[model samples]
Target chain A: MKAVEFQGLEVQYGDMPALRDASGSFETAAMTAIVGPNGAGKSTLLKAALGLIPSTGRVAFFGKPLAEMRARVAYVPQRASVDWDFPVRVIDVVVQGLYRELGLLGRLRLSHRRRALDCLERVGMADYASRQIGALSGGQQQRVFLARALAQNADLYLLDEPFAGVDAATESAIIAVLKSLRDQGRSVVAVHHDLATVPAYFDRVLLLNRHVQAEGPVAETFTPEALARLYGGLLPQLS
Target chain B: MSALDFLAFSAPPMLIALLAALACALPGNFLLLRRQALLGDAISHVVLPGIVLGFLLTGGASTPAMMAGAALAALAAAALIELLQRSARLDPGVAMGATFTAMFALGVLALELSGAGAVHLDVEHALYGNLESLIWFDATDWSALITPATLATLPPELFRMAATLALLAALCWLFWRPLVILTFDEGFARSLGLPVRLLSAGIVAAATLAAVAAFAAVGSILTIAMLICPPAAARLCTHRLGPQVALSLVFAAASALIGYVLGGYGPLWLGLPASVSAAGMIATTSGLILATAALWHKR
Candidate 1:
C-alpha cells in the first residue's frame, strides 16, 4: 500500500525554488533514503510532505489526505536544528510524542509513562531518562530523538538527517532499529547524507536535487549516472 | 508601630506587589523558554501610549478602559513588529526596538500635549510608577475590615492585580501541556495537530494582559524585570519546567516582599530620612536574585 504520496509539490524560499514540481510515493513496509547533495531540498521535501512549510501540493497517506491521517505519522526533525541547551529532561521530550493522545488536558497515566520508558529502552536511552537533554552527546541526542519518534507509535516515520553526526556503533544501532520498524510493516523515510551506506542501509533510494532525480529500489535507481547527475558530477564510485 | 498598624499600612502594598510579580512571572517562563524575552519588553513599552490614550479618552484612569486601550496597543505593536520583520526583512530586535520606542515616544508626547502633567499621567509615573501611593487608608477601625464597606474601600490596584493573577493562573493551568510542548518543540507540536497559531497568540495576549495589569503599580521596567528575571533565576535552579515555574513564583514573591520591606524601611535602618521607590527596588531585587542563582549554579 502507498503509505505516502506527493504530487506536483512545489516549495519556494523567497524567489529561489527549494523543491520544484516534485512528486513521489513511498510504499508501506519499506526503508526509503532520500539522497542528494547539499541544497538539494531533501529536508524541504520532507517538510512539505508533512505541510510544515508553505507548499503547493497534494499529499496523501494511504489514499487519504495528510490532515486526515496526521495522527498516524511521526516526524523526527534534524537534531542540529533544535536548541540542545533547552532546559528539559530526556523523559520530558519523550512524553511530548504522546501529546496527541494526551491532548491539551489529558493526564499522563502510569501506562503512558511505562510506554515512554519502553520506547527509551528500545533506543538504549533508558538510563538517561532523568538527565538533561543538553548533557547528551551528539549520538545520544539522536537516539533520544529516535526514542521520541518511537514513542509516537505511528505507522509512518519521517526522519531528517538522523545519522548526520553519530558514531559507528550508534549508526548501526539506528539502522537496526529502522530495519525492525520496516520488518513490522511500517514505512520509514529518512533524509540521508552518507551515500556509501545507501544500498546497505536502505531498501529504496530517492535521489533528489530540488526535484526527484531518480527513485526506485536501491539496485535499480541509485546508479552512478543518476548520482553524478544529482551531485553535479561530483560522483563517488558505488558498488 | 503595633502589629495592626503594620498590617494596615504595609500588608496591602506588599500583597499587591507580590500578586503583580506572580502575574508577570507565570507567563514569563514560557516567554523565556521560547526565547522571546524581548517581546515582553516590547509589549511593556508599547502599552504606554495605550494607557495615555485611555486616560485622555476617559478623563480617568479606570482599569477596564486603560486595559482595553493597552490591549489594542499591544496587539498593534506585536503586529507592527511582525510586519517589519517580515515585509522589510529587518531583524526581530531591530523591529521591536523601532516599534516600541516610537510608541513610547508617542505616549510621552501625548501626555505632554494633552496637558496631563498636572494629573498623574507623566513620564516619571508611567516608567517608575507610584507603588508607594497605593495605601489602604479607608479602614478607620479594625471592625471595618470585616464590614462590606471594606470591599468598597480596598485599593483598586489591589483588585486589578488579584484579578489578573487569577486569570493568568487559570490560563496556565488550562493550557499547561500544549504551552510546554509548543515551547519545547514547536515543530513536533504542529505535527501533533495542535493549534500552534492559536496557542502562540494566546500566549502573546496573556503577556500583554500581564504587562498592562501590572503597569499602574510596577511600571513597565519592573514588569519586564519581573517577567524575565524570575524565570531566568528558576531556570538556573532546576532543569524541569514544572519545578522551574514553581521556583519562579517563589522567586517573584520573595522579590516583591524583600523589595517592599527594603524600599519602605531599609533607609531608616541606614540612618536615612526617606524611603525609596518600591517598584524600582523590586526590579533590582529580582535582578539580584537572578545573579545569585547564576552564581550558585556555577558553584
Candidate 2:
C-alpha cells in the first residue's frame, strides 16, 4: 500500500511557481529520496503536502486525508528552518514530540520524561538531554530533532535535508535509524541534498525539478540521464 | 519615604506598574522568541489613535470606550503589518517599521486636529502615562488598606490591571503547548494539527490586550519596555523556557518596584523637590537590567 500519494500538487510563491503539478508517492515500508537541483521546490512539495502552505492538490496517506493521519506521520523540518539560539533544553525538544500523548494542558509527568529520554537514547542524545539545545553542535542538534520525531512514534517520517550540515557520523547514524525504521515496516522519505548517496541510501528515488522528472526503484530511475534531466544537464558525476 | 507614606502615595501606581510589567513580560517571552518584539512596540504606539478614536466616537473619555479603541487599533496595526509583509512582500521588520510609524503619526495628527486632546489623553500622557496621577488618596494609613469602603475607592486601573494580568495568566495556561510550539516553530506546530494561524493571531491579541491595559495607566514607554527588556534579560539568564519566564517576572517586578521608588524619591533625596517620570524610570530600569544581564549574566 502507498504511504503517501500526491497528484497535481501546485504551489506558487509570489510570482514564481515553486511546485507545478508535482505528483508522486512514497510506498509503505520503503526508503525514498526526493532529489533535485537548487530552487527545485523539493521542500515545497513536502510543505504543500503537509498543508503548511496553500496548494491545490489531491494528497492522501493510507487512503485518507492528511488531517486524519497527522498523528501517524512525523515531520522533521530542515535544521536551518529553526532558530538554534532558542532557549529550550535538548530534552524539552524531544518532549515536544510527545504532544500527541501529552495533549493540550497535560502536565508533563515522569513517564513522559522517561519516554522522551528513551527516544533521545535511541538517537544517542540521552547524555545531552539536560544541556541547552544551542550548546550542541549542528549534528547533535539534528539528532535531537530526529529524537523528537522518533518520540512521536509516527509510522511515516518525512524529513527535509536531514543529512545537510551534519558530520559523517551523524549521516551514518541517521541512515541507520531510517534503515531500521524501514526494517520495522515503516516508511522513510527525505529531501536529499547529496546526489552521491542516492543509490546507496535510498531504495527508491524521485527526481524532481518543478515537477517529478522520474520516480521508481533507484536502480532504473536514478540513472545518469534522469539525473542530468533533473539537474538540467549539470549533473554531478555518478560513479 | 516612610512605609506608611509608601503605602499611601506610592503603592497604587507601583502595583499597577508591576502588574502591567508582568502582563507585558509574559507575552514578551513568546514575542521575543518569534522575533516579533517590535509588534509590542507597534501595538503600544497605535494605542494613541485607538483611544483618540474611541473618544471621538463616544463623545467622552470613558475607560471602556478608550480600551475598545486601543484593542481595535492594535488589531488593525497587526493586520496592516501582516498585509505589508505578505501582499507588499516587505520584510517583517520593514513592514512593522512602516506600519507603526504611520499609525503613530496619524494618531498624533488626529489628536492635534480633533478635540480628544482636551481630556486626559494627550501626547505626553500617551508616551509616559498618567502613572503618578494613579495614586491611593483613600489609603491614608495602613488600616485604610483593609477597610472595604477605602478598598472600594481604589483606582479602577488597579483592578483593571489585576484582572488583565489574571486573564493573561489564565490564557497562557490554556494555550501553553500551542504557544510554545508555535513560537519555536510554526510549520511543525501546524504539522502537529495545532492551529498555528490562530496561535499566531493569539500572540498579537495577547500583546494588544497588554498594550491597551497598560498604556492607559503606565504609558507606552513602560509597556514597550516590559514587552521586550524583561523577557530578553530572561533569555540571557537561562535557555529553559520555564526558568526564562520565571526570571522575566522577577526582572519585571524588580524594575517596577525599584524604578517607581527611584522615580518618586530619587530626586527628592538628591536635593531636588521634583520627581521624575515613573514610566520613564521603569523603562530605563528594565533597559539597565537587560544591559547588565548581557554584560554579566552567566549560565
Candidate 3:
C-alpha cells in the first residue's frame, strides 16, 4: 500500500508559488529523499504533505486522509528552527513525541516516560537524557530529536534537513536508524542537500524546483538533464 | 525583615509574582524560542496608551476599566505590528519599533493632554508597584464560596491569584503538545494538523491577560522583569520546558522575597524608603539571577 500520496498539490506563500502541480506516490518501508537547491520547494513539499502549510491538493497516508493520520506520522524539523538553548532536558524533548497519543492535558505517566527513555537508548543518547539540550553537540541534539520521533512509534516519518551540521558518526547513525525503520516496515522521507550521499543512502529520489522535475528509483530517475533544470541560474533582470 | 514581616510583605507579592512569572514565562518561552524577545518590551510600552485610553473612557483607575483598556490596547498593538510586517513586508523589529513607539508616544501625549484629576501613575510609579501601599489596600473584602466539607480555603487575594494562575495553567496543559510542537517547529506543528494560527492567537491573548493582571500588582515596568528574566534565567539553567518553567517559578518566588527584604530593610541602612524602592529591588534581583545563571553556565 502507498504510505504517502500527493495529487496535484499546489502551494503558495502569498503570490509566490512554492510548489506547483506536484504529484507522486511513496511506498511504505522505503527510504525517499527530496533533493533541491535553496528556494526549490523541497521543504515546502514535505510540509505540504504533512499539512504543515496551506495547499490546494490532496495528500493521504495509507489511503487515509492526512488529518486522521497525524498520530501515525512523526516529524523532525530542521535543527536551525529549534531554540538550541531551550531549557529542556534530552528526556523532556523526547517525551514531546508521545504528546499526540497522550491527551495534552494528561500526565506523562511512568510507562510513557519509560518509553521515552528507551527511545533515547535506541539513539545511543541514554546518558545525555537528563542533560540540557543546549549542552549537547549538534549530532547529539539531532539524535535526541530522533529519539523523540522514535518515541512516537509512528508508521511514517518526515525529516527536514536532519543531516545539516551533524557530524559523520551521527550521520551514519541516523542512516542506520532510518534503514532499521525501513526494515521494520516504516516509511521515511527526508529533505536532503548532500548530492554525494544520495546514492549511498536513499532508495528513491524526488528532484524538484517549484514543481517535480523527476522521481523514481535513484539511478533510474536522477538524470543530468533533471539536475540542470532544477538548479539552473535565474533569468537576468532587465534594466 | 522578620519572617512574620516578610510574610506580610512577601505573600501578596509572591502570589502576584508567581502569576506574573507564568504569564510572562509561558509566552516568554515561545517569544524566546521564536526569537521575539523585543515583543515583550513592545507590549509593555505600547499598553501605556491602552491604560490612558481606558482611564479616559472609564474616567478613573477602577480595576475593570484599566485592565480591559490595557488588554484591548495591547492586542491592538500586536495586530498592528502583524499587519505592518505582513502587508508592508518590513522587518519584525522595524514593525515592532514603529508600532510600539508610536503607541507609547501617543499614550504619553494623551496623558499630558488630559490634564484631568491626577492619575496614580507617574514615572516611578509606572515603573514599580508601591508594595507598602498594597499592604494597606485592603485585599480582604472579597468572600469565598467554599463547600463546608472541602478542606481548602484561601484569602481573597490568594483566591484571585490562584484563579488567574489556574486559567493560564489550564491553557498551557491543554495545549502542551501543540505548543511544544509549535514552539520547537511551527512548520512541523502545522503539518501535524495543528491549528497554528488559532493556537498562536490564543497564546497571545493569554500573554496579554497575564501582562495586564501582572501590571496591576507590580506596575508595567517591573512586570516585564517577571516575564523576561525568569524564562531567560531558566534557559541558562535547563533545556526542558517543564523544568524551565518550574525553575523560573522558583527564581521568581525567591526574587519576590529578596525584593521584600531589601525594600523593607534597606531604607534604615541606605536612607531609601522601602515602598519606593521595591520595584528596583525586584528588577535588580531578577537581573542578577540571569547574570549569575549565565556566568555559572559559562564556567
Candidate 1 lDDT, B1-299, residue by residue in tens: 77677656787888889999999999999888877788889998888788778878899867677778888999999878867876678887898899999998997788789886677666777777777777778766687678887756778889889999999999999999889878877777778878877898788788888888888777877899999999999999988889999999999999999999999888999999999889888999999999999999999
Per-residue lDDT tens digits of candidate 1, residues A1-239?
69898888999888899998998888789999999988989999988888777899888988898889988999998988788878889998999889888877898999999999999998888999999999999999999999999999999999999998998888988999999999999999999988888989999999889888778999999888888888889886664
Question: Can you give the lDDT of residue B245 in candidate 1?
Answer: 96
User: Over the stretch B1-299, how does candidate 2's per-residue lDDT look in tens digits?
Assistant: 68887777778889999999999999999989988899988998877788889989998988899899889998999988878876888998999999889999998889889966777776787789899888778787789978999998888999999998999999998888878888887778989999877788888888888888998899888999999999999999887898999999999999999999899889999999898999999999999999999997753
Chain B TM-score of candidate number 3: 0.85
lDDT by residue for model 3 (B21-125), tens: 556666676666666667777888888888888888888787677777888999998888777876778898899899889999988898899953276757666
TM-score of candidate 2 versus the correct structure, residues matched by position: 0.97
- Docking class for model 1 is medium
- Name every residue pair that clashes in candidate 2: none
Off by over 4 Å in 3: A13-15, A228-239, B1-30, B82-92, B113-124, B137-162, B173-178, B271-275
Candidate 3 lDDT at B218 equals 70
Q: What's model 3's lDDT at A51?
A: 74
Please give the lDDT score at residue B225 for candidate 3: 80
Best by DockQ: 2
Each prediction's TM-score versus the true structure: 0.96, 0.97, 0.84
Question: Model 3 chain B, poorest ten-residue lDDT window?
Answer: B136-145
RMSD in Å for all candidates: 1.8, 1.7, 5.3
Best by TM-score: 2
